[model samples]
Target: MSKLVSENISTLRPYEPGKPIDELERELGISNSIKLASNENPLGPSPKAVEAMQSLLAEAHMYPDGAAFRLREAVSKKFDIPMNEIITGNGSNELLTLAARTFACPGENAVISDYGFVAYKIVLTAANVPFTSVPVQPGFEQDLNALAAACDQNTKLLFLANPNNPTGTYVGRKALENFLKEVPPHVIVVLDEAYVEYADADDYTSGLELRGLRERLLVFRTFSKCYGLGGMRVGFGVGPTELIDYMNRIREPFNVNILAQAAGAAALFDQDFVERTVKANAESMVLFKRALEDMELKYTPSQTNFLLVEMPEADKPLGGAVYQAMLRHGVITRPMAGYGLPNHLRITLGTPAQMERCVGALKAALEEVQ
Candidate 1:
């Protein structure tokens, strides 16, 4: 065998996604399983998106438009940003990786919260760029002041996941604005609003509202979460046109595939689907919290579709074993060992019946272990 692999990738661990339905079914000889592990929509993809993809299938033989011009136009109009300021990616994950490559060099560094999104560290590691992760506050809230302290001249980017993943905590508009105000001009803030749509804080400011600070912040949004198109992996970033121009240079011409582009554009206008998803997710969150309260279990309050529950016991396959047991009972939730929270699990809020299954399975799993 030839030793041709780059050292960066040779030892790097790839992102391990949750077990699929087929794999679980094969292992346990069970069928008709429900997966809330991946944070997918129980209501399914938008009808508009489905119809759009169907119409575009016949054109699959042709190469996709390199720039994704039409989709950019729709995004710009919807977000009220200029078309030149946007860069579409396969998903927000791709954009995160691309940002590392575009801005940070071999010796430069990026700053992030210690318990933040897994990809922030993964992408930096994969790129061979140094990174510093400041620990969060006791309640898993981002310490923006600590982030400022962590950065120096080498820090090219700062990733802030509002309504942060796994933890699902968010800062109000005033807090974020204050953080941005103190941010140095040299560093670009990547505000990841992947779960912002589900965040119902009255004072929360949409990342789109920060367009005036284009040079200092780039806001990343996904069609995957609120729009229900995770399988297609569609997302975009709005920011400084000059910065986007440089990043777009490194992107694959057809990074956002034709089908995803078409579907995403259609889904953008499917307000009915979005409204229904937002409403159902709100109800599910309340239901879960009430169930946990009744059971006397402790859980973090979340503005997003998922919640982080403190187990205070079990990690990994033990935590994951609990996740497996849940599968056997026709429910699936995500273990957080991979995210360095060995004692916590992230459960996506589902439809009413699905939430009921999740709660029942979780209680049984804990009792079984106890």
Candidate 2:
């Protein structure tokens, strides 16, 4: 069986997502566990989106529109992009992999940040394309200079996660623009903006705004983070018409479901819901940072909905122990050992009440672990 597997596939390590609430509850025989692991919208789905999905439940017998026409049109109007340049996916994750598969050839390479989204490496590897991991600079920021230097003639694709995950850092407009100018024209750049909705930085630039600056740029967005539609698994990408057409050629028919299409379109129209979600996340993030300050815990200041907290040094590695302690107290967080930060934990900011509870649990967990 091992011999039958391709070297790339055989050596690959799958991504480990945050633990689900139900799974943690079952494992600990606990009730009412608060999960602030995966960065999710604490406000839940928009009422309009819920209504739209519910209305479509009766149409389950029919297959989804293969092209996601309505959703694409809504996205085009919302973002001011042409419909032909947009493509939908099961999630932004799918589109990322699709880009790798469509562009990367065997023995070629892609460029990604060392601590960027883990899924990029997985997808590139699965496509049998080797990739270079550019080390992050101070404060966990993507080293755009190193990334540009790493690319050569063999580089086919580049994946950049603005307001990158786990570390939650971002690149400013000038830096990104300068970097883009240096990248080879033949290399396709995929800007993964899954958490862009939650980012409030004044200088942060959405790749969509810079699409015209580069011919080979693709911007990916997802409803999973700020829209509270993780369960629906719907995301969209905007790129050159030719690149989008190539991705569509390889896309599975009905890749997005009927309910997802309806909900996504409704979600886009419900600006009030998105505003409220953003407001709540902004307030909760402040509260979490203050709590960490009071606890004398150092953490990465983030523009996204999560914080990467550095645990105090103890006799042993405390990340896993602190995580277990939080779990026992009915609070779930993501340990960052897999990202090579064994002493750090990544925690999602939840609603106000949930944040309070999480702080309390963290306080208790820290005492126990110490």
Candidate 3:
């Protein structure tokens, strides 16, 4: 079996997702556990999307529209981009891998931020494309200068996670513009904006705004985060027509299910629902930050709907212990050891009730660990 597997795939470690609520409850023999690990919308799916999915239940037996025609049109109208520039996927995760598969080769390399989304490294490694990880700057933000310096003629893809996961930090518009200018024309730049809808920073720029600036620029968006459609597994990529065409050619037929397409298209039109989610997240973020401050704990200021909290130093590493303590108390948060931040935890902001529960659990967990 080892001999049958490619060396790259054989050595690769699979991604570790956040523990599901049911699985954690079963393990601990507990009920009503709240999950703030994966950055999912706590308000649940949009009402419009739900109605659309319900309407499509009778049509589940039919195959999905391979081109995602209605969804693509919806996205185009919303973003003001041409329909040909869009390519839908099972999720943005698949599109990220598809981009690498379409553009990079074994000997060529890709550039990614050290603390960027873990999926980028996984996809590149699985495809046998070596990748250079540019170390993050102060405050856990992506080092655009370092990324530009790391790329050379052999670099094929560059993955930048704006409002990066685990850290929840982002780059400003001017910095991104300058960085784009420095990047060579041959290198494809991928902006993973899964959490863009929640960003409230004055300087944050959506890669969608830079569509014609660089022919190789690919912006990935998802229905998973702000749109509350993670279970549906639908996302899309916006890039030049040629790049989108290449990705579409290699993508699996009916990659996105009929329900996902219907839900995603409906979600796109439900701007009011999205606005409510974002507004709720903003209020919750403030609550979490204030609670952390009151407890004398440190955290990164975030543009997205999550925070990266640093646990107090103890006799040993506190992140894992704190995470375990929180889990035992029916609250689930992500320990950042896998992202090389053993002292930190990534917590997704939920509703006010959920946030209050999480903060209470955190205080209790700290007391126990300390």
Candidate 4:
């Protein structure tokens, strides 16, 4: 098996998603567990999206439009981008993989931050392309300058995530603009804005707004986080028409299912739900942050719907142990050992009531571990 497999694929360690509530409850012999590990929308999908999917249930036997025409039209109207420059995917994860496969080859490398999304590394490795993981600045912020410096003639791609996952840090608009200008024209920058809707920071601008700065820039957005369509698995990428065309060539037919297309299209028009969701997240985030302050825990101030919290430095267990203890209390949160922050955890903001419950569980867990 090893002989038959490419070395890059053979040595790869697959991305691990957060633990599920059902699996945790079954293993612990408990019930009513709440999960805050994955940055999921707690308010659920929009009524319009649900209605659209429900309307299409009888047509399940038919194949999805391979071109994703309706969804692409909705996206175009919503984002003011041309439909010809858009490509839909099963999820934005698929688009990332497609970009890696389409633009990169063996001996040509990609660039990413050490604490960037794990999926970037996975996709590049799966494509047999090596990547340079630039060390982040203090406080886990991506070092855009260093990342730009790391690129050379061999660099073909660069993956950047605004309000980056597992850390929740973001680069300001001016910094990002400068970084984009500094990167060589040969490198195609993949700007992933999966949490763009949740970001309330005035200085944080979406790459969609800066597409003209770099000819090779590709911006990826997802329905998973803000639209609550994670289960449906719908996401899309917008870029240069030629780049989009190349990715489309390699995209599987019916990459996004029929229900996902309908749901995503309807969700784009349901801005009311998105606004309500953001408002609720803001209120709940205050409560969550207050509780963390009361516990004297340090956390990275986030622009998105989650916080990256550090464990107490003295006389407390590491993230993994604290995570296990919290599980016994029926609250599931993500530990950050895989991202090399062994003492930190990434927690999603939930409803006020859920956050209150989660805070109590976390306090108890921290006490037990101490």
lDDT values for all models: 0.86, 0.92, 0.92, 0.93
Residue-level lDDT tens digits of model 2 in 46-144: 888899999999999999999999999999999999999999999999999899889887768999998898899899998998889999888898999
Candidate 3 error regions (>4 Å): none
Over 4 Å off, model 2: none
**Against the correct fold, how does model 2 do in TM-score?**
0.98
lDDT tens digits, residue span 200-240, model 4: 88899999999889999999999999899988999999999
For model 3, name the residue pairs that clash.
none
Off by over 4 Å in 4: 315-317
Query: Which of the predicted structures, 1 or 4, would earn the higher TM-score when compared with the native?
Result: 4
User: Pairing residues by index, what is the TM-score of model 1?
Assistant: 0.96
| TM-score on alpha carbons, each prediction | 0.96, 0.98, 0.98, 0.98
Model 2: number of backbone collisions: 0
lDDT of 2: 0.92
- What are the per-residue Cα lDDT tens digits for candidate 3 across 247-359? 98899998999999999999999989999999999999989999999999999988888999999987777999999999999999999999898889999999999999999
